[model samples]
Target: MNKDEQLKAAINQKLIETGERERLKELLRAKLIECGWKDQLKAHCKEDFKHKNTLYMDKIMWTIMQFK
Candidate 1:
């Protein structure tokens, strides 16, 4: 309607988006921990003599073997 009303609406929309982003960050952190992401990263790390198994990597081991 008015310039001031439009500005308020825009500010409110931005605040809602920011809140959603923060909630998403927290949810993603929880999912990463639940899925063993930290452990999976360590397992696939480029270190020697660390042949740890991971869910996705196990499926692609044939291709990985070509690199070794």
Candidate 2:
């Protein structure tokens, strides 16, 4: 693998071994909920579903990134 990929793998391995990844995920979830980002994302998803009658993850994320 390239140097960048190798560095990413090493960092990910350290995070996993130390359980920091899960902790960071939990913290991010809590922060999103606290800031109403979770609710906003849910509303956006529901609105998109209503208009399209189908939910596509890639489309949803793209729209969300634009919205942000």
Candidate 3:
């Protein structure tokens, strides 16, 4: 993995290890928005950066991993 992938992986691992579903959800939302998931997010929800969940995160992260 490259730096970005590594970083995302680290974050994902940490989030998984936290053992708190709400905390994980909140952080996943914030991180996804922060990391440019907005456009796709808008398409997914008909709004921009409104909310996020682990449901879409792996897909987004996979897309991210495909770049560069």
- lDDT (C-alpha, whole model) for all candidates: 0.66, 0.88, 0.66
TM-score of each: 0.39, 0.80, 0.32
Clashing pairs in 3: none
lDDT of 1: 0.66
lDDT of 2 by residue, 29-58 (tens): 999999999899888777766868666789
Consecutive 10-residue window with the lowest summed lDDT within model 1: 46-55
Q: Where is model 2 poorest over a 10-residue stretch in terms of lDDT?
A: 46-55
Query: Which sections of candidate 3 miss by over 4 Å?
Result: 1-19, 43-68
Q: Which candidate is the best by lDDT?
A: 2
Cα-based RMSD of candidate 3: 10.8
By TM-score, highest first, what's the ranking? 2, 1, 3
lDDT of 1 at 28: 90
lDDT by residue (4-59, candidate 3, tens digit) is 99998887887678766568778988988888886564565433224544447666
Worst 10 residues of 3 by lDDT: 46-55
lDDT accuracy of residue 19 in candidate 2: 100
List clash counts for every candidate, in order.
Answer: 0, 0, 0
